[model samples]
Target: MKTHALGRGAPQVTEFCLGTMTFGTQTDTADAHRQISMALEAGINFIDTAEAYPVNPISAETAGDTEAIIGEWNAANPGRRGEYVLATKVAGEGLGAIRDGAPISRATILEAVEASLRRLQTDHIDLYQLHWPNRGSYHFRQNWSFDPSGQSRADTMAHMEEVLVTIDELVTAGKIGHFGLSNESAWGTAQWLRMAEDKGLPRVVSIQNEYSLLARLFDTDLAELCVNEEVGLMAFSPLAAGLLTGKYQGGAVPDGSRMAINGNLGGRVSPRVWDAVDAYAGIAQAHGLDLTQMSLAWCKTRPFMGSILFGASSVTQLEHILNGLDLTLSDEVVAEIDAAHKAHPMPY
Candidate 1:
């Protein structure tokens, strides 16, 4: 796996970040452990998870179970904690399991960090992220209905300042190495950057947004901002919820797969999305590339990509993804992908 700077002055991480949202829920503890070992053995040293994980049926019952699984791996690994750069997120408001769906405030940040530390079995998080903006975000197929017109500028600024200051405290106290955002917009990220600079608070190190062959919303303005501001883009759902894997090309959902677990891939499988997947799959076949690898490698081609987070329900699935880590997409393949994208833009 290739290494890249996480963000400005942040730790270096593998270009591929292992995603663990399936832990504890879709996957059991032993399986999760094996997956971790496989990823680390393959030189992927960056892992990302969320406090409200064990997803595919996120519930109050499995609320921090994913982190707990990692903690168990740490407990068994003994002193190998520093081998990988661990990253996790604090669930945003409306996740009643976490702080009763309260808005993110100074108190919430402090509380969430302590809880995450315990479940992760580590003293500090390498990259602490806000799972979603408190003001709401356009991710998770929410773009069509997202509206910020009702938001108050003063209130938003106040909230950002307070959160930044609290994150600054976490940085100073060694609870977290750096702060990041997930499912955020370009404007929201720019505001955070401006606030951090103006208030001398810690700047955001990364933004975990949904970006794949089917989801290119980040290509225009956010990509430019992330590149110029030194904030890395941590892309999640790189396969468009298994659509790019080609296993679901004919509406076939393998048992225990993400699609089989969460119907419609969290509503990502729109009317036009399947056609887009087939086009990309055709390109992969034409170029002798695995669809999954082609999709992941294409993500790395973006100038602003910090890392691509991929999840696996089984060891075989993980191994399949790791096979693409060393691939470098050629200019011809990239051009074909671009052409296919133009023909079928914004499937989701």
Candidate 2:
């Protein structure tokens, strides 16, 4: 696996980042640990998890279980902690399980970081991300109804400065190495960079947003911002939540799949989505490529991609992706993908 600089001064991370959202729930502790080991063996040096993880069915009971599971591996493997770059997120507002649904503020970030450190069993986090913007976001299929007219520019700038100050304090105290954002917009990210530059605060290193053949919202504006401003993209849901894996085709929900738990695949199910999957799957078949690997490989080809985050419920699934990490698409195949995307835009 090739490595890329996460941001201006951040550590180098593998193109493929092992995502551990299903660590404690769908996957047991032993299996989760095995996945981590497998990823390391495959030369993957980046791992991402969140405090509000195990999220096929997020709950208060298993809120921090995923981080604890990773912490267990860190505890057991004492000397190999530096083998990989570890990243985790602090949950934003509207999640009842964390901080009683409080918005992300100075106090909330400090509190969340300390708790994340305790659960992760690490003194310093490589990349600490805000799970979502406090004001709200257009991600998670919220763009269709998203409106920013209600937002106050003054309040938003104030919140950004406050968060940046807190992040500065964290870096000074050696709690986090770098800061990032998730589920954010181009405008929001630009303001963060502007504030950091003007105020001499620590600039954001990356943004974790959904980016795949099925979800290309980041391609236009955010893509330009990332490439120009040096903010790398940690693309999540690169497989379109398993839709690109050809698992949910023909309305066949496997017994233990994500579709089984969340029937709509987090609002990704629609008439056009199935057709889009078929088109991409056909492109993979014609080129004799595994769709899962093809989808991931395509993500790596993007200019702003720092790392592509992919999760698996089992070790076997993880192996399938690892075995084909070297797959690269041809020019013809990429053109076909682009054409298919134009034909079936925003399926969800």
Candidate 3:
């Protein structure tokens, strides 16, 4: 495994970040703990979770269970916490289970960080992220119907400033080490960086947007922004929610899989999505490569990639992905992938 600098001053993290979104729901505590140990043994030093995680079904009861599972591991190990950079998020608006769907504010952020700290059983968080912009986001398959006209610029800036002020306070108090964003647009990210620079507040260190062969919303303006501004991209769903693995091809949904749990796989299933998967799978077969490894390996080749985040329901799956950590795609394969993208752009 290789390491990359998260931001200008943040710690170096492995190129592959272990995602624990299913730690409590799809994955049990014992398996989750084993996965953590396995990831560490394999040289992965970055782990990402969210307060509103274990989200196969995403209910209030199991919302913080994932962090608690991780906390249990932290409590047991007690001494190896320093080996990894732990990152979590403060849920933005529209999650009714948390804060009654309230938008992110200074007060909400304070409350969320406290809860996350307690759940993670850690004194400090390496990276604290705003899960999404308060105004709204175009990610999560919302680009089809996204409308930014309803957002007020003055309100948005005010919210950003208030959050920055809170982040500065958190850093001063040693509650969080750095700040980041998720599901944010290029303009929103630039504004955060601009405000941080102008007011001498904490700089935005990273952005964890959805990036993969199927989901390329981050390729245009956001790609340029990350490359120029040094804000690393923690790409989530690097496998397109398992579509790249070809398990869900031909409408065959395996039992206990993400698709079996949630039929749409978060709006990723469509007529064209299967076709796109077939094209990519064909390319993988032609090159005699595992589709999963090929997809993840391609993510590493991007110049702006900081780390590719992946989640597994079982240790077997994790080991399979870990085995391919060193797989590198040749230029010809990458060229073919680009051509496939041009043909089946935005399949979902």
Per-residue lDDT of 1-348 in model 1, one digit per residue for the tens?
679798888899999999999898778899999999999999989999888998878888888999999999999999888999999988867466766788888887888889989999999899999887888777778888978898888988999999999999888999999999998889999999999999899999999999999999999999999999999999998988788889987768888788787788887888998888889999999999999999999998999999999998888888888877899999999999999999999987
Which of the numbered candidates is closest to the native, going by highest lDDT? Answer: 3
User: lDDT (CA) for every model shown?
Assistant: 0.90, 0.92, 0.93
Model 3: residues >4 Å from true position, as ranges? none
Error of 2 at 68 (Å): 0.3
**TM-scores of the models, in the given order?**
0.98, 0.99, 0.99
Backbone clashes (count) for model 2: 0
Better of 1 and 2 by lDDT: 2
Ranking by lDDT: 3, 2, 1
Model 3: lowest-lDDT 10 consecutive positions: 92-101
Tens-place lDDT digits, model 3, residues 79-123: 999999999999878566766778999889999999999999999
List candidate 1 stretches off by more than 4 Å. Answer: 94-97
